[model samples]
Target: MLTVLPAINWLSVLVAFVLYFGLGAFWYLFLFPKPYRISLGRSANEPQSGNPLYIVGPAVCSLIITLTSAVLLYALNVTSYGAATLFAAVVGGGYLVTNTVNIAINPNIPRPFLYGLITGSYHFVGLLLISLLLVAMR
Candidate 1:
């Protein structure tokens, strides 16, 4: 079967990608640092090492994820806000959040729900905002 690629709105995709990536920076670094550290069972006073990988790695992953989401939205021809939001919510909340919770639930991990809530909610909100931007820009 021959599959035709959709004409992408590059500007929309770029904006959505950046916004989603920025959301993560704000989410973990500043907004919920205390809860995030607590979720990992780390002491609030324990000095965090200035590790570049810890900062850069997740940023890179977020960028890739945002780009992938933008591409999918374009390919799916989601032009309306309602459709875009619905699609994003399904992909983000249903698939991504569900999987995150599941993985975090393994007995090896402590305070699994805390970690799951933090990451899962971020994905859902990030994807929702990305969808909104993509639709509005279109």
Candidate 2:
């Protein structure tokens, strides 16, 4: 019974994807531009890249994450609000946060922990919202 296709809610997935991507935009651009730059070991005065990949890449990733979370929520039959929150927390903290920290542990990321803290927090919150929305819409 691994088929989650029939249980999927496309509308919720769309809304959640928007919320997830929108949150990323707000998080990086408005909320923590300076701190994020510092976490990347870059100065405020440094020239930012205008590459489309920067935008497109994360959008794709967010969509994937959203869709995946939606499938899991439906497949696992997480219907209650409290259960959704707990599931989100577990998935967020366990996979997203841990993976963010792991990705940051590289030579390019001078302040790995700081970067992890910033990005991981975004994913954590995004997952929470996504799961909640999915459950609510279901």
| Candidate 1 local lDDT, residue 50 | 92
Q: Mind giving the per-residue lDDT tens digits that candidate 1 earns over 16-129? A: 777887888899878887787777788755666699997788778777776777777777878899998898889998887999899989876677899899989998998899
- Model 2 per-residue lDDT tens digits across residues 7-41: 78899999999999999999998898888899999
- Screening candidate 1 with a backbone cut-off below 3 angstroms (N, C-alpha, C), the clashing residue pairs are none
RMSD of 1: 2.3
Q: What is the C-alpha RMSD of each candidate to the true structure, in Å?
A: 2.3, 1.1
Off by over 4 Å in 1: 1-6
The lDDT values for all models are 0.80, 0.93
